[model samples]
Target: MSTDDADHPLTRAELRARRAAEEAAAGVEAAAPEDSEPAEPSEAAAPRASTAADAPEAPQVPAVPTADEPVTRSAAPEQVFDDTPGPRRTPNAGSGTSASTADAAPAQAEAEFPDVAPAPAAAAATRVHQEDPPLVPDDAHVEEPPADPQLAPPTDPRLEPPEWQPHPTPAPVARRRRFPLVLGAVIGALVLVVAAFGVITLLQGPRVSSVKIDAQSAIDASGTRMIITASQPLAKVDPKQVSVSPKAPFTVDTSGRNLGIRFTVPLDDDTTYTVTVKDATGTDKQRQSTLQATFQTPKSTIFLLQRNADGDDTIFLTDLGGKNAVPVVQHEKIDDFRATADHLVVATEKGGTSVLLVMDRKGKNQRELKLPGPGFLSNLQVSERGNLVGYTFTDKGISATSGRASILVSQSLTGDGEPQIVTVGDKMPSIAQWAFVPDSSSALFIDFSGALYVEDRSDAKAKPTALGAAQTVEGISRGTYTAIVSRGNDLVELNLADGSEKPLAASTPDFGVPGTIAPFPGGTLRQVATRDATGLPTGQIVTRVDDDGKATKLFSVTGSDAIMQACPSPSGQYSAIVVAPKLVNNPYDQSLLPLPTTMQTHIVDTKTGKELVVLAGFDPSWCAQAPHR
Candidate 1:
């Protein structure tokens, strides 16, 4: 509502009448523009012709003009007078009385004359003299000011909602989200495929069928050990039927599989050789099976040396080329012996045997010289320049059951001197392993009681002092500087320089790489073929013991066929391993075990730690050590 309307109230019907009247009066003025001329007025408003009379500006008129007067209607609407109207009539004042131009003429003439002309800003754009059919004062025309412009207010543009802004085109919304959705779907499918494949693989057992060698015979040097491994349970197969062959002649062995093979034999650097299985079957009538493999024999051994498990045997030499060997010693059990520049001292079991034999370089039987005890021989040592000889043996004139074990040292066997009978102790020393102390006149020995003792030769009466409880006592070899011992699960690396022990594993800890170590790495453990606790087929593993006393698995017994027996070969190049990978005797149709699968003797290479040849077991361990390759 406007302030002006709020101040004045009027009935709705009366206000509408007033609005109509205003519109009608405006219409009369708007219609005059088409028919207007500048009028030179003869003034009815002129003062009486003489100035003496008081000017009559506008005289009130009689509605019924004086009886003698006539009505004048000139170019004015007749509706202005009540007595004379065409369509509309003004209200009568009394009888026939009306208001007209005559009454308003004097005022109109003065206003129109305009003694002082109107300024341009205030003047009307179109002048109209058309008389308004003047309205008479009556109940119909009388009205009060309107009351309702107050209650309803005009709409305020400031509060309206903002106009919608139209872009030239819709936004590129779909492509923005498309790439990630596609990428996510592709990734999801890949993951599902991988998951399904894993499930399928698990459902099927170990998938091994056609075994082929991926390695070529040429190039690879650090010689590799050829091993035939089983993917499934081998209780159904026979090892005797299996025969190994090499395309190129080289040493092969199962010892590398049972005993962790050495890793230093480089195929490229060492001489090249290859071995494969031929007629891989066993000869035992009870069983028949065959398993075959071929690998490089990278390094060639100049001499393959080994001592029999029996205490009396000296070194047996075998040629890695699968040739025959000859026995070097026949009479006494020589536990230890060394070749000297002029002579060789041998620890022999009987006094008739020479304590030292002066042999030619060819190892021909030469002159004998006497010195120490005629007891079981153990280890032998020579000086760096070949001037001194150190050897150990069980004390003589004492019962083998007696606890007294003795060691002797001599500058020269012929030069008579008291044999340094360095008695160990009242306790009988059981030999497990032994080594000559480097740069000193003493020997380190590990007894079966797990005690490490050093026999000092400085004082003739000095007993062997205990280093500590050792896991294993290993026998020493020529040019082997230190003793590799094992405690329990760990290997005690005995430093020859100082009587110290460093623990190490017999195999690589990762179990991915094979190594000759003490407490070995456990996997498909290969042990020396033997019997298990249940009296079932088993094998022995030469695991080095740690000072902490732990056993790690190195290898386990695995034969393609039931193995009859396995013995270390003459040269240690190969062990007399008899087995079968394929078993021909079917229990469903058994006929004398289907004529035993072919069994063969295989020469094992100790360097690369593999077999050199696989043949029948007609060979003996008495062969020579160094056979020309």
Candidate 2:
């Protein structure tokens, strides 16, 4: 070689080309017959001495001894070299040569000394080797250097070292490396979605989840509870915010996630009631929603007494439709009967005395309820709230100085104790007219001297409360403790709870003065006598006078038929009007409390003034006691 060529040091491409040529020659020698001796490397394949002097010191390879000497292997681990392409190392500033030139020097020296080839038996003894395992397992895939060295792609000198890094050691092949990474990403996404849903739920208003109510209790008595459950905790609700259709008196109570509504009076039967709560909000108060629910009440069942002068007097139970009449109790002479939630109390006359029989609603399981003494039972009534049956009693031969006379008495329906006699001060005065107050254990009565008193049967030792003189107690309202009583010619509303008095409000359009008034939940049923120009009786009008004094005519009898009595239902939705049709011909029965034999009761809707049905009975179960003459 020329001196100038030796001084210039070969480029990386030239060195790589020369190395490829020597490797091809060594492989050819290895493929030759085993018995043939290996050919000596050509002079052109030898590396220049100057190239070795400029290169970095490589790992020391044990020298192979000649055949004339004994061949021996070193105990040290085999030295390995990697040919896989990788990031170029930064060249040291002290070194005059570039990184590519230094890296090529070792390859050039190994190529020049082809005589140092490894023994054929040792497969791992190679100077240049691939770091990666073969991608395909087949003999046809074994790699070899190209036959023409110039065909290889040339490396650029300006190529930068890569920014990414690789593992220090080779890793085993994995068929499912991405499985764990994909699963982790899916789980993280689900957690984010769940968190978002929870935030939305908390920000919204509460929704009604469920509702519960008892239809029987709602129609039978007062204090029926309806529970409404919400999806989340609720805020407090004021009683004024709640409204019930077919309006009834109620109170509101609230707890966590539940709202309770208690009806203070019996609800109308066979009616659809809608309860609505306005501007109901959740505990967070983030949003507001109106809560509403609807439920229907069961139909009402009433019992009426039909008296027969010849045969047996019967007390039959019937529905408002006047159909399905079932005989509940029968006796030779039936005086009066009253119905409670679950049972019936009938006052029957046996021989010359009075007998009180208590039985189930279906008239089964009949049992006797003892009276205060062996006197007659006149006004029989029941107080459902106290479960007590009361009556006005008089001796068989009642006189001014004989047995007990017109004494008021009460007893438990369960027959657990003796009958209790009501008294005012220290005397059991003769009771003239009396009635049990609605939904209470108190009795509003007037003595023979027209003295009015309120006595609580539940409290035996307490003195009776006197509210001056009242001619008669027409009726007492259910939830409100107001009694419609007559004082002289004007009607007055007496507040039994506080003994306050106020004149009864006159109905609108001024329907004149009514003969009798029966107070109910929201109104009063007044029997107004419609007079003609001569100021004589013309017709009887049963008018419904509301608490606001608005009157609506329910039923009117203009002919010989007379409206004997007009009583309001427990809920005041309908009024039961007893009419003696053909009063001149309908003879009076020979009973203690005589009534026209051909009497028919007209069930009229108080609100719309619609007559529901005409039943062949005088006294309706809606009345607290039989109508007084």
The TM-score leader among the candidates is: 2
User: Per-residue CA lDDT of candidate 1, range 20-125, in tens?
Assistant: 2333334422221111222222232122111212212222222212111112222222233222112323223322212222224223323443343332211211
Each model's TM-score? 0.33, 0.67
What TM-score does prediction 2 earn? Answer: 0.67
Displacement of the residue 230 alpha carbon in candidate 2, Å? 2.7
The lDDT for every candidate, in the order shown, is 0.36, 0.70
- Find the 10 residues in a row with the least total lDDT in model 2: 131-140
Name the candidate that leads on lDDT: 2
